[model samples]
Target: MDWTRQTRFSDPGRHHERLAALRGDVAAIGGVVRNLTVHYRASGIDFPPSRLAEIDTRWVSRMLDLDHERFGGAPLDTPRPIEQRLVGCCRDAALLTVAALRAHGVPARSRVGFAGYLVPNFHVDHVIAEYHDGSRWIGVDPGVDLSDVPLTPAGLHTAAQTWRAMRRGEIDPSTYGVGPDHEIGGPWLILDYLTRELAHRMGDELLLWDLFGEGIPYSRMEWSELPTELPDDLTHLDEIADLLIAADAGDDAAEQKLGARYAEDSRLHPGATVFCASPRGARYAVELASVNQEAD
Candidate 1:
C-alpha cells in the first residue's frame, strides 16, 4: 500500500519525465487540464465527437499524450486558452495530480467521493487528491485555475459519509448527484459510488462512469428501474460504509479487513473488464490493466 507509487490509472508511462513540470504542485494542475462538460457548457458550445472522445483517455499517459499533442511540452503551469486545454473531469484531474505528486515522491491517492462545494446545496459526485502531509492525510481539490482567487478549502464528503447520512435521515438523497437539476441522486447512486470509493482506496482508481460487478447500474435509466426503497443490498452497503469509515479513522484492523474483502470479493473490486457507460450514450466493455503489487 505505497501511495507514492503510481497505480495503473495514474501511471504516466513515456510522459513520466514531463511530470516534473508539475513538481508535486497540486494547485498548478488546473493550468494543464480542462473540465470536459464545464468547458463546452461555459463556452456555450456543443461538444464535437472528438472532444467527447477525450473522456475515454483513462490512463494518465494517454491524457499526457493528448496534452503534449495540443500544447507541445509546455510547463503544466503555462496558461492556455480554454479550447486548448485537455478535456477531462474531476477524476482525470485528480488522477493527473496524484500522478504528479507520486512522480515527485509524495504519497498521494485519488478519493472517489461526493463534494458539496461544487454547487450550492448539492453534493456533486467528485474526485480529489489526498496526500500524506507528513503525519496526516489532507484532501484538496485539484485543477484550480491559477487565474481565479483561491477559495477556502472545504472537506470532501465521501460516499461513505453520504450513505451513512442517507440511512440516518440526516440529508436529502435527491441533493447528492452530478448536477443540481437532475433526477439522478439516491441510495442507488451511493451504492455505486461506495464501490468506487473502495476501488480507489485499493489503488484501482477507475473512470467515474465505468461500472463493474454483477448488480451495478450503467446509467440513470438502469438506476431508475431499481427500487428506491430501503433494504435492497442496503445492509451490504452499510457494512461497507462502516468499514471504510473505520479504516479512515485509523483502525488498522478495519483497514486489513477491508483490503482482504476487496481482494476476495469481485462485487467490491473491478474485474478484468468493466462496462463503460459513456456520457455520450454508449455502453461497451473496456479492459483493465492488472495490478502489480510488487512493482514498487
Candidate 2:
C-alpha cells in the first residue's frame, strides 16, 4: 500500500451509520477547540478543567464514539452543538476533519506544523486539515474557525511555507516556537515540523506526542542542546521541502520520491513505541511502531 494513499485511518466507511444520527455545522466544527479554551464561555456553561485535559484519542472512530457517549442520549448536549465535548488537541481535530471530508469523496489530509498568529511572538505547534479542490490544496484549521479572521501566512502556513520563510529570513526563527515559557523554536522546531509534516504528507499523520524515527526531542531538551542533537546532514531537508511543494501540487513523481526517501532514512521511522507527554504533563506509551509495517 502506498503511504500517499488513504487507509483505514482516513477512510470513513465505518462512520456512515452515524452520519445521519446527528448534524454538524462545518463552520462551527472548528470552534470546538476554541470553545474548550473558553470553558464554553460563549455558551454560558462552565465545564470542569479536567474535561479539557485528556489527549489520548487519535482515531476518528474513537473520537466520534466518545462524542456519542457524551451526547448521544442527552438532550442537553444537543442544545449547544459547538460545545459538544473536548477530548483532543489540534491533531485530533485535523484527523477527524480529514475523515469527515474523505467520507464525502474529498481528497483531504491532516497537516502538522505551527501557527504563527494564534499566539503572540510564537509560532505555536499546530495541526490542520487540507482539502484539494482539483487544483490547489486549501488550508483549513480544524481546531479554530477562521471564518471571521482573514486567511494570511501569519494565520495559517504549511510547514513547507514556514520552512521556506525561515530559510530566507522572512520570519524570525527565534519567534517561531510553542509558547513564552517554552521557547522551543529556531532551526530545531523547523526540523521537528519538517519530519512531522513530511510524515503527515505521506499519509501517516501521527499524534502530537508520537515520536518518529531518530527525531530529536526538542520539546523536552534545553534550547542550547538542539544544535548538537540534530542530524549533521540536513541538506536533504531542502530537497524534502521542494518535493513537498511539488507533491502538494499533484506531482506523483515527487510524492513517490518523497515516500521512497523517507523509507530509506532509518532516522525517519514510520513506527516506534515511545513515551508521549499529555497536555497535563503526564507520560504514556503511544504505539505507532507497527503503523508503517501494517500499512505495507
Candidate 3:
C-alpha cells in the first residue's frame, strides 16, 4: 500500500487495518530480501555496520556540507522558519520511517517521548519508531546519525532512563518529550493543538500522528505548579523554568528568556555540544549533564 500518500488515521479501523497491511507487506517484502539473498546471492545488499550507522543520524543535516548536499540548503519538508517548521519536518520523518520499515516487512510504529542528548537544541526529545522484529518491539530512531561521532555519555544512555525519569516526575511532561504538553501518562492540550495545526497544514492528514501510534503521557499538571523538589541536581532549574514561562508569555520584556537560560546552562556544564541554536533545549541538556555528573 502506498502509505506515503494515504492517511493512516482516517478511521478507527485504520490502525488495525494498517497492522494487517504491514503483516502482508512484510510477508511480501521479507520474501524479496530472502529472494535477493538466496536467488541473487547479492552480498552487497546487506546493511554494513557503517551504513547502519549512517542511517541512524542522517535525518537532519549536520554541517554546512550536509545541509547543502542532503537538504538543498534548507531543513527537510518545510518552507517556513526553522522553529515553526519543526513539527512538519519531524512528522514527515516519522511517516517516512513507518513506510520504509513497512516496505521492508518490518512491523513498525512511531512513538513520541523524551530522547535526552548531549547537545543543546530546540528539541529535547525525539519521535521515532518501535519496530516488531517478529518477537519483540525495538526502539528505532532515525532522527539523526550518531555513527561518525561517539555517542556522548548523555546520549549513550538507554531510552529507559528518560522513561523512568518521566514516570518518576523527574522530567516535566510538557516540553520533555513529543510536544509541549504531552506527558508520560497521555496526550495533552499541546499535542492536540500541534496535531491539529499540522493536519490543517497538511490539508488534513492526522494519520501521520498515528501511522503506528501516537504516544501521550499517562497524566499531566499545570507547569505553573510543579513540585518544590526538582529533578536530580537541577535545583536551579526552577529559576530557568520561570524564565521559560516568561519567554513563552512574551519576549518584549526579556531578550533571552527561554534561549538565554538554555545557552547559559549549557556552557556551565561540560558535555557534548552539537550546533543547535535552541537555547531552551540546550539548557535542558546541560541540566541533564548536571544530574548525571552529580550521580557520578
Candidate 4:
C-alpha cells in the first residue's frame, strides 16, 4: 500500500466523519502550548503529572474514539478540532495530521527523528508528519510552530539525515538526544531512531518506547556504558540509512526492499516486549505477543 493510505492506526474510519473537523490553522498555534490536563505529555515543556495512570492509546483511531472523560477532561461526544483538543504530543499531532491529510486523499506519513532547533546544542527526539505535494515530501510539525525559525523542505532533520550528517562530521553526535538532565542523543540514539523510522516507513510504526535490538534499552541513559553490547555488524546501518532515504523519496521498490531487510534483521525486528513509560515516569514492559493476541 502507498504511504498515504490509512492503516488500522491512522484510519479515523467511523470515529471521525470529516477532515474539516480536524484541520487547524497553523499560524494561530504556537510551539510552546501544551495540553496540561492529559496524562501523556510529549514536549520539552513540562506539565503536572496526572493522578490516574493508564496505558497509552497510540493509535489515531483509538485517540479519536476516546472520550474527554478518559483523560479527566470534560466530556465530548465527537471528535474535536486540533485547537479544542488536549493532545500536544508530536506523535499524537502527527498522527492526527496524517489522518486528516489521508482523509483528503493526500499522501502523508509520520516520521520519527530529532529536531535540533528545539534545544541549543541538543537534538531532541521528535516526530512529524510529512505529506507529498506532487513535487516532493514536505515535513510538517503539527505539535509546535517556532515562528522564528524559517521553514524549508529540509528544515526537519530525519534520523537518516542526522546519521549521515553525523557520519560526515556535519553535526556533533553529542548534540542529538532527549532529556535535559542527561546526555541521551548520540550515535546510539540516532541509530535507534533510524531503525524505528525505517520500521515506521514499512508500516510497523511502533510506540515511542518500543524496544528494538538485543542490547539497546528504551532509555539511553540506562546504559551503564555508552555503545555497549551493540551488534557486531554496525556497518549495516549505512545501508539502512540509504534505504530509508530512498523510501522517504517515494521509491516504492526501496520501501519493499527495506521491509524485507528490516524483517530479516534481528536488531530491527519487533521484540517480544515493549517498554511503556507512565505519567509518573515509571517504566514497565508489556508482552508483545499477549498484546497482539488481545488485539486479535
lDDT of 4 by residue, 1-296 (tens): 58667875677666445443433333322221223113144423343343223225556655544533454433232434433345435666677677767776778777888876666656678877777777876677756653222222235678888887777778877767775555555777788888888867766666665556655555434544654544566678888888888776768898888888877877776666656643345566656544222111
**Which digits, one per residue and each the tens of the lDDT, describe model 2 over residues 1-296?**
23224554554344544432323444543443343322222236544555544455555555555565666644212443545565466777677666655555567777766786778767777777776666766778755565322224676566777777777779876666666567556677777788788887777776666555665555444456655545566677778888887886778899889889889986554555644554444555666533222110
Point out the worst 10-residue segment of candidate 1 by lDDT.
145-154
- Clash number for every model? 0, 3, 17, 3
139 in model 3: Cα distance from truth in Å?
A: 2.1
Per-model TM against the reference: 0.86, 0.75, 0.30, 0.74
Instruction: Please give the TM-score that candidate 4 achieves against the real structure.
Output: 0.74
Clashes of 3: 17
- 119-198: candidate 3 lDDT, tens digit per residue: 34313444444456566545544445222111122332222333334445665544443333334222132233232222
Error of 4 at 151 (Å): 10
Q: After superposition, how far is residue 118 of candidate 4 from its true place, in Å?
A: 1.9
Error of 2 at 261 (Å): 1.7
**Local distance difference test, each candidate:** 0.72, 0.60, 0.32, 0.60
141: Cα error in model 4, Å: 0.7
Model 3 lDDT-worst window of ten: 33-42
lDDT of 3 at 282: 18
